[model samples]
Target: MNKILIVDDEPNICNGCKLILIEEGYDVDTAMNGSEALEKLFEQNYDLVLLDIRLPDISGIDILKQINEKRLDCFVIIMTGHGTVENAVDAMKNGAFDYITKPFDDKEIIKATAKALENRTLARENKMLKKQLYDRFSFDNIVGENHQIKEIFDKIQRVAALDSTVLLDGESGTGKELFANAIHAHSKRAGNRFLAMDCNTFSPALMENELFGHVKGAFTGADKTRPGIFEIASEGTLFLDEIANMDMNIQSKLLRVLENGEFKAIGSGKVQKTRARIIVATNMDLKKRVAEKKFRQDLFYRLNVFPIYIPPLRARKDDIPKLAYHFLKRFSRETGKQISGFSDDALEMMVNFEWPGNVRQLKNVVERLVIMSDTHQLSRGFLSDHLEIKRKGGVPDIQTPKTLDELKAAKKKFLTVYFGKIEAAFLSQAISRADGNITLAAKNAGMQRSNFSAMMKKHGIVADKSSD
Candidate 1:
């Protein structure tokens, strides 16, 4: 329940306000003077305080000052009589939430009290939300120990303090968005908005409208004027992902903003300005796109001011174990599982295999592992199913197949090599399990010793010649 303190020198007014608030489902207290109000405020926490500007002993403004100095979690509404309205305004400037004039009725008092308490609730929610964002996106939460990763981390720390444009280039799933978020969180604009948009998610026209909002009647569905992210973000940060896919026309407009920090809403002649920092990301080379005339050279140059290249997972194999365990710990707690750790073989599989999708892919695989686990440890079997499928994925960067015969032949060749690898690994593990005895391995696999020996020889795997 919201508790309110009514502080007034007049006994009738203070007690009457207390009764009114209590009847409205609030826990109300009455203070006959400034000293009494300060005493109660220090002894307990109240949601709202109704204080008179003129008190016999200490002034209401003095009590308000003490509350502000103590940083007490309460809202104050100054109560002033006819000639003391100016004093009430001065009291408000000293930290009172609002002021109610004298000769106020029940309706006026209730409205003021409700408005102050509502603002208090909203302020607390906003504070909690900001804390959550800071905790989740802080640089400390990013798991990486590789040299390239360390360098990138150091680079971000330096650039995050600047207002210059940043360009992040990496593979599709290398976590460019995560880096963008970290940059915004560490920047001077951290207290403001951090808005993001995927350039590839919208067409040229829609993308322009989203970046620079439109005036009413600017489009078919226009009902009222709207502020775009550039306006909404104001002096904060704007992260643009997949920027390479942006249309040429939109790129020109973006270049103007980078050049002069000014933009015009669609269908409006008035020019508006923004100081929002730009951070663009892409999985492709913007320089190459500029050469190909698919992207604007001027805009590409502007965006490439501070480039941060994120290394792919294959280039940072050493960090795979740590990244995997990081995801493991996260997913374990989320899924309510007690997964202790991964097996050595499983770790080897994770490190040796190439993650084309990069860190995002590794995180997803760990999530699945957590779901499939029944024991405290994640075994190699759980990983083999996922990695084997990944290993067989993707084709070589050869010419595109045209004829049906060529497509069929390509498929056949791929499956043949794929099965060969699977067979070799299977045979090697079976031999080791059988203590290098081909006879026992053949018996276990329900195959003849001669057939097993022939298979091992064809695969160039030496057999137990002395045994079977």
Candidate 2:
């Protein structure tokens, strides 16, 4: 139910307005003066206030200023008996939502109040929709049914409710920012604004001003007072990406803000307080940098309260199939394509390959395939030829397999084709790299010693024992 506050000095006008609003199904309250209205405002929340211009003690403009200074979201509809076109315009400039002339009709009052309430409702709904959309494409959007990916999703949800600063450690293209945004969207301040800043994109001066705001005439472009992300995002979340790239001075400033919730505007004497949640993400080795004294220890501690480490794609190969299909559906709809999905061979190749650029690289490759490939289903040739991803590693001089089938056949038919010849070559290389240690040679191939012996025997390859 919406609450409306009506403030007026005249008894007849105030009572008439109150009766009309109550009959229209509003919870109405009447204040005879500015002091009484202020008291009522402090007592309970109001959706809209019908403020009188000719108050007994306070001016209507002063009331508007007080509401704005308090940063309340209630809409104010000005009621003026000294009604001039100038008065209406001035009321609007002072943050009044709208103005209704005194001795107004019942229809005008009802229509004006309804419109103001509708605008407030729409503004709130828009904010909610943005928050929902942001959370929908968040860390959970990584899209993998594998245990490893599911674990990461669970971690994101678990840490989101806390006020601790999160350090998302992941390789490049691992969707670190997505995780940070997810955390922010799920936090208690989800209704507030979420601001993101890329540390790599700003210089120290611009970054400090952008984070902490500046007073007018603080620097060259100080024509007007400007609020920074921290001020704007107060009671919300601030996501800082590529945090390692930030300058040392800015790092200390960020540390101070996180520690004390206080920062001074550029060239300003006043210190401002922020209650924004900080979520920092980086791909660099902060520990190594800290040991080198290039990164500040205090800032590192403030950011690392809850660290989320994401492994590379190579370590989570089981998730490739799910990720591939997710990206496939996304790009197919985006590009107006009827692509079916990846073929069996394509999935196998993806599982065997190392994704150096991680999830980001995979998403790009899927987009490329969706746009360029003529077939409904993705093929191994498209992945291998277009993406240039190697399914298996070897020397640079090694010849490419004739086809993906040949590569697959190489795995299943290692006995007949490359048995004697390839076994000897592999054994010789392994022995040379391992300095004639059989145990080390076996370990390098991720094979048991017995399995290595069996392979050597099946291929009729001989390795000479070392002479003491």
Candidate 3:
């Protein structure tokens, strides 16, 4: 039950409020004066306090001041018989959550108490959500043991606590936003907002309004005022992904915010200031973009205060086994599969294949593998049939031949299986690049359209309906 305390010198007022609040399902306490109220407040934690401004022993403003000094989380509603605007303002200035006159009815008191307690509940829930977000993005969840990854970890450890701008460079699916979240969660402003924006996902005008917000009547269809990410994250962090893809017009405005914490909302003459820390990421070479005149050199310099590069999965093959097993364990529990681990040959196949889509691709593949598995261990042939991964200089396993006849038979089997995998992998890659356009894919591979379609049917690869 929500606890409430009523502080008033009038016995009738205190008793009436207590009875009304108790009927409303509250644990209500009464104090005849400010001193008794303070004693109760210090002795117990109350969700709401209903205080009268005029008390016989002490002033209610003094109690509010003490509450502020001690940094109590309870809400306060001021009550005064003197119904003057000045008294209400005074109460509010001293941190009163609400103000009411002394002649208020039972309905008024109940409403005030309910509203204050509602806010108290919301505050507790907000704190819990922030804790959950911090836990989700904590550095412990980022799995990697390679030396290159360790170096990045050291760099993050050094810079995560700083307010400098961060630039993350990596291919897609390398978890740039994860690094951004880690930085924000470790900073002094962790308790405040942390918002993310993708420059590539928004057009110039929309991006402007989204980053700087707009005032009411600033543009057509902009009926009411909206606060942008910059204003919302003023005391927190704003992460910008695909920073290199931002248009030049928007880049200039962003540069202004970086140079000075000032920006004007769209359609408004008023300038707004934001103290939000900036973190940007890109897959392209930023310096090259600057040289090509596609990106602003000044903005590039401002964003490069701290740079962290995440290597692709192919470059960190040494960590593939650990990553694979990690995904296996997670997917096993999620899919309720009895599969325990991978066969040695299966692990070798995954390690040898190039994962074009990086960790995300590997994760998706493992999820599917666990879902499809019927045995305790994953085998190389099973994985190969599902993955269609073909790499150069790798042949099907064959034992030493007992005689010439056996050798010929082994070569025939090896060539047929190995070359067939290559053909299937080729067709799959072509169709994917062509967006399922079989004719275009066949042309790209320098083959006839009918031949490509036949091969796709033979391999059970579905093709989308696209015009030649």
Candidate 4:
């Protein structure tokens, strides 16, 4: 039950509310004047207060000011027989939750009081959630302790408080998106949503419509009004991932929006403004692309305002051990395995290998080794064959295949080595996995999608089995 305080100069009015509230399971208290109400307020905590404006000693507005000075967390509802709009507005300005005229309905008063309590509860909950999220992914979540990564972290801490356009450049495996998330989390706009979209996912035809929404019947599939990412991400941060893949024509429109913070939706005449901070990521070398005339030079300059380069895993081998241990612990816990730390040999193998696929590949390999290992300790033998290069080991000699003089000869030899059969069986397996879709299968085998087709014809890899 909620505690209620009713303060009014009229004895009949105060007694009536007290009797009704007590009957409805409230711990009701009554006061004849603002002085009495103040005394009662200090003595006991109440959830809601029904205060009469024209009290004998002091007005309700003065009482509210005194209550706010004391910093009590109670919702005040002002009641007055004067019933003037000016009086109601005055009461509202002095921290009153609502203003009710005398002879007000009982249901209306109860509804307003309930709503005030609900608002207080929601306000406290939102504050706590904000605190929790900030603590979880703060600067400490970044894993690397290398010199370059630490420098980047220092720069992030400095720049996060400002409103700047951040450009992240790195290879595909480098964690550019994570850096973008870190920027938003540390920024003043952390409470707002952090929206990310891959610029390459949309085609030229739909790119404009997707970024800036369209109206009903704007095109063939337009059924209703739609809000674009810009509109939805207003007053937030928008991360454009794989920005190098966006079409040339769309780049001009995006650049204009970045300059003026305003853009109109497709098929809409009205202009919309946004205060979103834009962060763009690109794996491709934009300067090279610009010199080649494949990308716009002007747009490149606009996005390169605060460029942050993410060093690849191979460049910072010092952090390899830390990343490996992090992934090892994560994989072990996830798989319900009691895996001890890696052996010295295993650590040596991992730290020496060039991680072409970077941290993502390291994580995948660790998880796989953990699942396959019977013992808790992971040894070098559990690592991938590629990582274990032969050095000064006293192991038994292994048979070596004949060397190939040319690329074609080596490719043919690779097929035989993988399939353990003649050239025909190798071609059959490749084409089969391709589902007769030779280009896709070639890509699956890490070959050029286009070049694979040519190789298939040269090696008799693709054929109509029915014709055979």
- C-alpha local distance difference test of each model: 0.83, 0.79, 0.84, 0.76
Q: Candidate 1 or 2, higher TM-score?
A: 1
Error at 40, model 1, angstroms? 2.3
TM-score for each model: 0.73, 0.61, 0.68, 0.71
Model 1 Cα shift for residue 337 (angstroms): 4.7
lDDT of 1: 0.83
lDDT of 1 by residue, 1-468 (tens): 999999999988988898888888999999998888899999999999999888999998889999999999999999988798888878878888999887889999889999999999998886776677777877678888889988988998999999989999886678888888888877777778898898766768889999999999987888899988899998899999888778888889999999998999998999999999999888767788888898998898899899999998899999999999999999999999999999999899899988755777788778888998899988887786555444335432234679998888777655645676678678877866774455678788888978887886544454322210
- Per-residue lDDT tens digits of candidate 4, residues 367-465? 778788889898886674323243344232234546545656656544444433344455557756754344445667787856755654433232321
The predicted structure with the larger lDDT, 2 or 3, is 3
lDDT of 3: 0.84
Q: lDDT ranking from best to worst?
A: 3, 1, 2, 4
Provide the RMSD of all predictions against the true structure, rounded to 1 decimal.
Answer: 14.3, 14.7, 7.8, 9.2
Which scores higher on lDDT, 3 or 4?
A: 3
Q: Pick the candidate with the highest TM-score.
A: 1
Residue 382 deviation, candidate 3, in Å?
Answer: 3.3
